[model samples]
Target: MNVLCSESMKIEEEVSDDSGTAAVHSLPTELLVLIFSWLSVEDLALNVSKVCQRWKDSLYFRTLWCDKELIYENSREDLFIFVLSVAPALKQLSLNPLFCGDPAAIVNAICKGPKDIRKVHYNLSLFPAAVASRILGHYKKYVCELHLEGYANKHSSIYRNLDAELGQMSQLRSLKLSGYFDTKWDKKVLERGCLNLHHLDVSLIQDESDSYKPFLDNVKSHLKTLKLPQFKSNVGVLELVSSCTELKEITLCLDDLRCISTLQSLESLHIRWSDGVLKSKMNRFVRDCPVFGNLKELTLFYIPGLLATAIAKQCNKLETLNLHGITSCANIIKSVPSLQKLCIVDRLSLRMRHIQKLPRYIPNLRHLNVLGSFLNKGIPPKIISQLKQELPELVISSEPFVRYTKRGNKGYFTKCTDSSTDCSSDEA
Candidate 1:
C-alpha cells in the first residue's frame, strides 16, 4: 500500500508545477494505459511519453507493455534495450540480421528478457559461445519455434556445441536452420528432445546435400511439413519419406513423383524449379494416387504444364494455387473450379487477352494476385480496371506491372466468372 501511495505521490509531485491540465488528463489511468497500448514503441517514446509525467509513468504499467510480437530493426541499441526491459510478456522476438545496433547488447537484453518467449528468430552464431549458451539455456523450456542461422559442417567439427544446445529444447515444434549445416547433426539428440517437432525447413542452408534424412528419420511420424532443397533420389530418403505417415505439406523438386505418391496424408505440395518430367507419367501418377484429392494448396514453379493440369483436375478442395514462371495455365485454371486464391508471377509472354479470362476460368476465386513482367509487355492498365469493374466483389492486386486504384464505394455486381458466356469481348 505504501509503495503504491509513494509512486502516486511521485507522479503528483512531478506534475504539480504544471498550471493547466489537458482534457486528456480527465480520463482514468486504466483507460489512458488501454489507449496507449495501441501505440508503437517509437510513438510511446517520442510522442506520448513526453506528454506529461502522468503519461510517462503509465508507460511503466505492466499491462501496457505486453506485446505478443516484437521485431527489432534499425532501432537504436539504447531504445531497443529500453523496450525489451519493459516488454516482459513478449511471446515472439525477431532480431533482423540487418539490425543497426551493438549485437552483444541486444543479445544480452534477450537473455534478460521474458523466459516464456515461444518463438525466437535470430543468428546465434554471431555471438560468442558463452552468450549463445546463456540464450539457449534460458529459452529451452519456453521456445516452441526457432529460426536459427549459424555455421556447421558435416566433415569438420564447427558449431558442434550448437547441436548439443538444440537438443536441450524439448518443447521445440518448428525449426528453420539456415547455414552450412550437414549430416553431422546429432539426430539422436533431436529425436529425443523434439518429439513434437512437426515442421522442419532446411531449404536455405548452403549445403545442398541431402542431410535432411537424419531429421526425417527422427520425426517422420510427427512431421506435418518439410521444406527441403532439391529432390535427390536415394534408397534411404525414399524409405524415410514413405514412413512419414503424418506428413501433410512438402516443398521440393518434382523429379521423383514416386516418392511423393506414397504420402497419402499430404495436403500441400510445392514443386520448385523442376522440369523434364514426361506428361504421360504425371497423368498416370495423378490417376493412380490420391495426391491431389486431399490437397488444399499447390505451388507449381517451372514444372511441366501437364503435371499442373493433371493435379488441378483432382484438387476439388484446393483453396490456393500459385503458378510461377509457367505460361500455359488456362487449362490448369479451368480444372480447379473450387480454387479461392490464385497467384501468378513472372509470366513474361502472358497476353492481356488470356488475363481477361480469369473470371471465366475460376469463378469461385475470391483473391487474385497477378504480378510480373506480363504487365510490362505493352499491356494497358484499363484491362485490370475493367476486371475490377466487372467483378467488384472479387479482390485483385497487380503489382510491379500496373498499380490498382484504391477501391471506392461501388455497387456490387454479378461476377463475369458466374456468367454462362466466356466474356471474351476485350472492350476495355
Candidate 2:
C-alpha cells in the first residue's frame, strides 16, 4: 500500500510540473522592467522590493532609477548615496540644485559609487562654471545623454566654461541647451567638439532675433532631431528648419505651409498654434501641401480650424496623434485609420457617440489618452467603462499631471524613442 501511494504522488507531481503555467522567473528582463514600471517609485521600494530576494535584485538592477524629486522628499543624502551604490546598473541620473548646494560634491559622490552612468543631468547655471566642468569631466567617457540645462535664477548664470567642458564629452548622443545667444559658446561645442550628437533641443530667451540661425546651420546635416524654442512667429522657423535635411522629427509652429515642403525625411511633426495664426495659411497647406506619407506621428496643440482632418488625410501612415484645445471626432474617425495611439485632451466636440464610433474607425488602436474635462464637468464613467469593454486589448487611461522642472521660456514638448519620435528638454 505504501509503495502504490508513493508512485501515485510522483506521477501527480510530474503531471503538474509539465502542464502548469510558465514560472514568473522565466520572464525576459526587459518585459519584467516594463511590468514593474506601472508602479510608483515609493510603492516599488517600500512594497515590491520586500516581496522576495529575486524581486529586490530585479527591481534594483533592471529598472532605471529616475525622479530626482524623490531624493528631496526623503531628505537624506546618505539614502541617495545608498541608492547610487546598489543600483550599479543605473541607466540615468539627474541632479539639480534642489538636491544639493554643491554640484561638484554630488557628482564626486556619484562617480565614486557608480561607473556606468549612461546619462547625466545638471544645469550649468546652478553651479559655478568650474564645478560644472568637473561634473561633466567625471562622466566624459560613459555619459551618452547630457542635459547642460540653463536656469534663470539670480544665483546662477551660464558661462563659457560650461560650454567648453561639454565639448570634451565626445560620446554624447543627446544634448539640450537654453540658447547660444549669450556667447559664441553654441558654435564652440558643436563645431569644435561633440561630433556624435544627433539630438539637440534649444530654447531661445525671447522672440526678438534669429540668433540660433547660425547654430542650426552648423548642425543642419548631422542633426536628426531638433526642438526649437517657443517664440510667437507668424512665419514659423521653417526657413531655418528647411536646411536640416537629415531631420527625422521636429516641433515648431507653421504660419506658412510652404515650410514643410522642404522636409523630405520628416517622420514626426508637432505644430504649436497660438491665437493669431492665420487660418488662410493652414487651409492652403491642407489643400496644397504635398503628401507626407512617411510622417508617422503628429501633435497640434491650440491649433485653430479644420487642419487635423487635412493632415490625417495627407499623412496616411500616421500611427500616433496628440491633439489638444479643440479637436474633431468625425475628422479623427474618418481620416487617420492607421493610428495606434491617440491623445485627446479637453475636446470641445467629444461625446459618448464619438467614443462609441471611435472603435469602428481605428480598430488597431491600442492606447488612448482621453484626458481633461470640460470646465467642471468630468468624463462620464459610462463612456470610460464602454471603451474598456469594447476595446479589450486597448490600454486606456487618463493622463497624469506632469510637474515640469520649473523653468521660464520652455518651447517644445519632450518625447524621444530609440528609433521614432523625438522629445525635447526644457530651455535654459
Candidate 3:
C-alpha cells in the first residue's frame, strides 16, 4: 500500500511540475495519444481532457477513438452527443437501458453523424421499434455486427418493423438475438437478412419452432460459427446442420453427434451444460468419425469417464481443451498429445499426482490454467516449484475468479470478492 502511494505521488509530481518543464510534456503527439489511450473513457472525459490545451487537442487523434467502445451508462446525454460528434471513427456503440434520457435521441444523433460504426448493441425495450428500424436502415451500408435484445411478446409490432429493416442490411456479417422474437412472422425477412452472415448466436431465444430452419438454410453454405439455444431432436434442424459444410465452430448440447460428425471442417466444439445425452451416442460418434481429426479445440462441461477416455483416444492433435467439473485428468491427458493449452475450472479433486504427470502425458503442453474455489491457495507453491523445474518452458497461472482490469496503463487480473461487481473476461 505504501509503495503504491509513493508511486502515485511520483506520477503526480511528474504531471504537475511547477516549472512546466516535465519530460513527459515534451513527448511527441503520437506518443502522448498512445499514453492517453491506456486510460478508460471515463478517465479521458473527467480527468485527462482537463489537463491542458495540448492534451485536450490530442484527444482528437483519429486512432485514439477508432476502436474504443462507447457505452451510454449513467453519463449525461449531451456528453454522448459530444463524443458522437468528435469520435467519428468510433466503431462500436452500446446504448444501455439505464440512461436517464431518451435513447432514441442518441440514436438520432448517431444517424446524422459519420457512418463509421461497424457494431451496435441495442435493447428494444428501451426505445421504440420504429426508431430502431430507422437507425438500422441509416447504417445498413456500413454496420456489419448487430446485437438486439428483445422483450416483446409474440404479438408486438416491434418484431415486424425490425424484421423488415434487417433484410436490407447487405453488409451484415454477425447477428445475435436474445429474449423473445417472432421467429415465425419474421421467417422470410430473416432468410434475406441472414444470407450473408458468417456468425449467428440465438442461444438465448425462447422459441422452440422450426423458424430457425430458414435462417440456418440461407447461411448453410458459408456459416462459420453458430451458437444454438439447445440441442433437440428436430430432424429438420439436424438435416440443415449436416449441410453446413463450411461450419468451423459450434456450441450446442452434444445430444446427437451424427449430424456434426460429417463436418470435416469443424475446428472447435463446445458442449453446453444441459447436454445429458447417453454415452452410447458419444461412443458411436467417436467410433464412426474417429474424433473429428480436424478438431483443434474442445470444451466439455461434463462427460462420463468412459466417454472421455474414448474421445481422448482420437484427439491426438487437439490444441486446446476446457474442462469443467472434471474429477480425473488421466483419461483427458492421454489423447491430446499435441495440446498446447489447458483450462480446468471448478474442480476440487485435482491432485498433485495429476499435476506431476501432465508433462509425461501431454509433452507439447505450453500453458496450464487452473481456476477453482481454492484459488487463494493456488497450486501449492511447493508443487509449482517442482512443476517449474520439470517443465521450464511451460506457463502456469491460478485464479479464484476470472476478471480483467487496467492498472497503471497495463492489463492485469484481480480476484473478485464482491458479487455485485461485473467481472470482464476480455482484456482491458
TM-score for each model? 0.75, 0.67, 0.81
lDDT of 1 by residue, 337-397 (tens): 8888888875564567776887787777777776564653323546656675766656665
Compared with the true structure, model 2 gives a TM-score of: 0.67
Query: Where is model 3 more than 4 Å wrong at Cα?
Result: 1-20, 23-28, 48-55, 98-100, 152-155, 185-195, 231-233, 373-376, 400-428
Question: Candidate 2 clashing pairs?
Answer: 150-428, 178-428, 230-411, 414-423, 414-424, 415-423
Q: Please report the TM-score between candidate 1 and the true structure.
A: 0.75
TM-score (C-alpha) between model 3 and the true structure: 0.81
lDDT of 2 at 342: 85
Misplaced by over 4 Å in model 2 are: 1-75, 81-87, 98-107, 153-157, 178-181, 186-189, 203-212, 233-237, 256-258, 373-395, 398-428
Error of 1 at 332 (Å): 1.5
Candidate 3 structure quality by residue, lDDT tens digits, 355-422: 77888887877788875624434554555656666666777766423344556656665644433211
Winner on TM-score (2 vs 3):
3
Poorest stretch of ten by lDDT in candidate 2: 419-428
